[model samples]
Target: MLSFSRTRSPGRNTSPLAGGMDYLEPKRKSNVLGRLILIVSLTALCITMLKNAPSFTSPTSFSRSQEGVTHVLVTGGAGYIGSHAALRLLKDSYRVTIVDNLSRGNLGAVKVLQGLFPEAGRLQFIYADLGDAKAVILHIPKILLYEVDKIFSENAFDAVMHFAAVAYVGESTLDPLKYYHNITSNTLVVLEAVARHKVKKFIYSSTCATYGEPDKMPIVEVTPQVPINPYGKAKKMAEDMILDFSKNSDMAVMILRYFNVIGSDPEGRLGEAPKPELREHGRISGACFDAARGVIPGLQVKGTDYKTGDGTCVRDYIDVTDLVDAHVKALEKAKPRNVGIYNVGTGKGRSVKEFVEACKKATGVDIQVDFLPRRPGDYAEVYSDPAKILRDLNWSARFTNLQESLEVAWKWQKSHPHGYASS
Candidate 1:
């Protein structure tokens, strides 16, 4: 269902809901949780990796060592989750290096980090575009392997957190091949570079969208993956590819499948913004492909009347802080295993209205919403069965419920409406 070229849009533009992918609808449905979750998924697809590659953390990005501190490199560290994790690692006393393309992420996020951690003694930032695969692969591996002048040698990094990806659902749908190229293939470039560098501990930001709509509620890590959209499918492909690499490579991989990752850094430091409104990822796609997938007018509803509390959709919402904390904890893990999968979410569920209410409470704004129709290829209600993660990671959501996280997000939004760009 595509039909256009990939030429860049002139400026800011908002389209119809096209289901929950494009915009939010005002009306409520019978399946409260179901509809609610779909709504949250929109942002989730942006924040973490519901549409993106789930944000990851490098334990030793800056870690205490008998000698001094472990060097840590963060790809996409300028972005929301990456910046937050990067800042936390630096604060915890790890020497951190951030490499960002500055497409989806704001350079401002890195500025906040500079002011936050102060002292460039332990932190380094690089503006590297991964889009040029050959140049990137050749350049990064050399840095990781030999330590060069432009690439800061002498610092042996203990690990690398891969958070770089071109993430955008609607855009992905419009041009599936492009999303696959970056989110899936660009990651391959990172993996290859890391493999060549021999970085031991590598944490990945995978996503729950890999599972798509599940037959059972509280979907577990073992849920059958039948991604409905190009974005979800791309994530699934990335997970599979990473797993394969782990099968052969000696990389220590922890694959975290994030649910709805909401809220800010809690310390009022980092938050999510995309290339679209708050900003969505300025997605990369071939121009011919863009013209191929013509945008459908009005809206495209996948499914409205489901058997849930709300007719819309329901999703598991987790605090961004909780997610980053998990990353910092997983770093101490020292073992060679196939990519381990973990669901990051409060096993609890929340409706769209519930999330909105919390946002309203936090921001003290009743943001306008217009209801459209149901979206195809979407789940009725999907929450995480994070039991396995709790048992293994020994980490649970301490951020309370959806309302609590939303309040924190709202608070951050109120203080910095346009995100840290204002600051």
Candidate 2:
């Protein structure tokens, strides 16, 4: 209107379109630089995520950082059998991660293992309860919270060794729900995690109780699983779940139905340390040690009128060492999409009277034995054939001598009279 833009300076654009272009050039360049900076930042973030993320391509696929090292997750690793199994895994140079709620497990056993395998990356422990169907949060340092899924997501576990369960037969009869939840429900949780994470190998720590009171002498793998008590029934249900899941998955399953597990670590590092309150419903080995140590007035034989040799219940006493060995062998021989059900025992039965005598010989104490009536859910006799495990996994019980097994355990008990407290 005023003709103020009529004169064109030497460095100024005379055309309106050219002037608009000149004004937008700096803005366009700034926008382009901003986009480039954002792209570079996003690229760095993606690279960082890829570096930290777990490699979950296949069942056997592990991160390049952990190449050639098989990582095993041992549940209930603070308990008797689980602790021993973890010790064996660590000794074999395999990376191990132990998860235990410590409900019936002793943290001392895990501590002992940590002491033995003090090297970094050799062993780690996480306190977690598998009974929780929801997110089982693990309270670990650096990591504020870790659900069961998070555990599977973060760690590339090649296999899972499930040993977590409420195993007291008498207690299971009294509180059936506890057994169902702890054994059956908890096993489902672990199985779900294993399946979801595509873990290849699975070694289940089952019990011979699942066989119930079989009419046969040495129960085999094909023997009917007619569980009498809740403990056995829950374990059987868990076995069914695992078998059913393995049908469609590439998981290599090994269900080890263990008989009477006895003894402790042969090197005196770990042993059975049942809680004082649980001693009433604990194993015969624990009771024998308690009686020898004068913790209990005398060892009360639960049943002495069964139709066995000594008029007492008969059981196959398998050493803890031998049992763990069988587990390792089973893990080694597992095949993808194949399930192996094995009965782990000595293929020999020992009565309460015989066991008491062996305990006395081991402890050098004439422990007073009070004969009592048969408790509820008590079996007359239960043993394992172990033929299938021997044939397939090439595993057989080496610690067959009952007294020797008890002696090795007794030495630990005498040294640590108060179990882990004596440490």
Candidate 3:
């Protein structure tokens, strides 16, 4: 009996059966406390995760009131083509937000647009550089801060029209890294913002230079993209990224491979206003206008030894009006999860010599032409078929007459001798 049972002490269970139960009680209580602590920790973790989670719902889908009204974000909207495109979008009753760094673009163009569409929500202009990965806080008597991500986050954009880039071929050849950073890297930044915000429609302003010197004439959409210059190569790289991204997304994308862009807003409110330094590597139209205005002594035709008609480089020139029209059609016809690639030209090629003659007639000036040898990265000839765009979007170039297009542009040049600076 003495070995089997121990004497009971105060506040202790000495019996063998009772002792076992008593020993397990503290452990059971400890297990219950541990479970409560674990449950509390788990609940706190769940709450934090829920608080920090990103919303998958599209910003555009937040309101049924905005069903039919489409708000578009136009990058580089202060430049020539971009400004014209913004004007067209505004005229079509679509809300437009124009973002530009004013690097190659002009603040005067933005002012002209603001004057035209002074109605508050019809148009908004944001000064920003897409290449900068961080927030750009610009102070111009007024503190303005913005970034690509912030732009998409604040605005419920239905479509994005990306037209920002350093587009000079010669410049691109000299500074390949600048072209890559501006064209390719900046495009990736904008695309990332577009994807994060779940934007549905995208219109990329591409270049026919992406085709390099194709083996065939009148480049179709399916032509092999064998870009030669840094400009073309960078653009092609951006196109590949867009194509790959579209493959896995439901975004509607339209890549318009522009051959040559000329002319301006026919209303004389907007025009091509390249900086004085860019005249050498700027558009042929700008050079022609400069020579006509006596800003330059003569038009220096860079390439005149190519194996083409007139021994000059040939290109297809499309009017800004028709080009903007094509963009609108692409925007309207865009379908989810579909990509449309179109050669946006008049389906005809014009030699540089022929362009000079047309410019002479348009400006009423005997433009002295100095036919120089072929320049670096010069293509023999490049034009577009444009049949695919017509068949798909029911759009074709109406401003086919090069002389008439030049005349319209000349009128604006004559009036704005100093471009927007005249205003």
The candidate that wins on lDDT is 3
Q: Which model, 1 or 3, shows the larger lDDT?
A: 3
- Stretches of candidate 1 exceeding 4 Å from the true structure: 1-68, 133-155, 276-303
TM-score of each predicted structure versus truth: 0.73, 0.83, 0.82
Ranking by TM-score: 2, 3, 1
What ranking emerges by lDDT with the best candidate at the front? 3, 2, 1
lDDT of 3: 0.88
Model 2, global lDDT: 0.87
Off by over 4 Å in 2: 1-65, 133-146
**Predicted candidate 1 versus true structure: per-residue lDDT over 1-423, tens digit per residue:** 979754434442345433324333333334677878889988777676533432233333333333666677788999878988898898788788888888778898898888877774578788876655454567764443232222323335678777877665566777788788778876776677677667777888878888878888888988899988888898888888888889887778888888776767777777665544422223111111111222212112234476777665677877778888888777756366646678888888776555555554554544444455654345678788888878887889899666667656555555664556668
- Per-candidate alpha-carbon RMSD to the true structure: 26.6, 6.4, 9.5
For every model in order, what is the number of clashing pairs?
A: 60, 0, 0
Question: What's the C-alpha lDDT at position 122 in model 1?
Answer: 75
Q: Tell me the tens digit of each residue's lDDT in model 3 across 1-423.
A: 456755655555556667365444566779999999999999999988876665433333322227578989899999999999999998998888889999899999999988998885778888888875332333231112235677777788899999998899988888899999889988988898899889999999999999999998979999999998999999999999999999999999999999899988878899999988888899999999999999999999887778898888999999999999999999999999999999999999999989999999999999998877777887899999999999999999999899999999999898888879998
Error of 3 at 130 (Å): 0.4
Q: After superposition, how far is residue 257 of candidate 1 from its true place, in Å?
A: 0.3
Scored by CA lDDT, what does every candidate get? 0.68, 0.87, 0.88
